[model samples]
Target: MNWIEIAGHTGALLSSITFIPQVYKVWKTKSVGDLSLYMMLIVFTSTLVWLAYGVALNLWPVILANGFICFLSILLLYFKFAFSRKVIVVAKVKESE
Candidate 1:
């Protein structure tokens, strides 16, 4: 692949892995109260658009990257809501400090 194409894939890989630490932290701590639902929603929506564009253009890298990123977003979103009210309140309280 050309340098430009390689760069694109590199960017895609980096972006796709961006959420790994966040996901791991949240999952381990079970604390997502500080995370904004709206932001996650926006990311999810944007990824969907990116995925669609990639599909339309027949870009595998884009498709794979956005697809994985979208899944992470959705997983985080679910964690935010799936967390119990008590846990959320405690998490928020801790975040305030």
Candidate 2:
């Protein structure tokens, strides 16, 4: 492959791998207290748009990278909701006491 293809693949790999730490932290802690749900939602939506654009253009790199990002973003959204509900329950219990 040419240098351009190598660079594109490298960039895609790096971006996708960067989500690993966040995923691990959330999974290990079972918490997403500090993460911004709004931001993630926006990003997830943007990634979906990018994936669609990639599909239209038939760009494999864009499609692959955004696809992986969409997956990770969904996980993050799940954790965000789960943790937020936990926090609310805790708060309500404390208030009741």
Candidate 3:
């Protein structure tokens, strides 16, 4: 591959991994207290747009990166809601006790 393509792939690789640590941490700790819902929504929306752009242009790097990012974003969103509910339920139980 040419330098330009290499750079694109390199960027794709980096972008794809950006959310991994955060996802892992949230998964491990079952905590979403610090994660902003708006930020996650914005990122998820942006990744979907980028994924569409990549597909329209047949750009493999963009497609791969954004697609993976989309998955990660979804996981984060799910985790945020799921964990938040758990926290709320626990709080209610504690209050009742």
* Backbone Cα, N, C clashes tallied per candidate: 0, 0, 0
**TM-score for all predictions?**
0.79, 0.85, 0.88
Error of 2 at 56 (Å): 0.4
Ordering by lDDT: 3, 1, 2
lDDT of each: 0.89, 0.88, 0.94
lDDT of 3 at 28: 100
Candidates sorted by TM-score, best first: 3, 2, 1
lDDT tens digits by residue: candidate 1, 1-97:
9999999778878999998899899899988878888998998999999999999999998898989999999999888887756666888999999
lDDT of 3 by residue, 1-97 (tens): 8999899778879989999999999999999999999999998999999989999999988888889999999999999999999988989999988
Q: Which stretches in model 3 have alpha-carbon errors above 4 Å? A: 1-5
Collision pairs in model 2: none
Query: Of the pair 2 and 3, which is ahead by TM-score?
Result: 3
User: Candidate 1 lDDT (Cα, whole model)?
Assistant: 0.89
lDDT tens readout by residue for model 2, 12-47: 899877777897899899888788889889879989
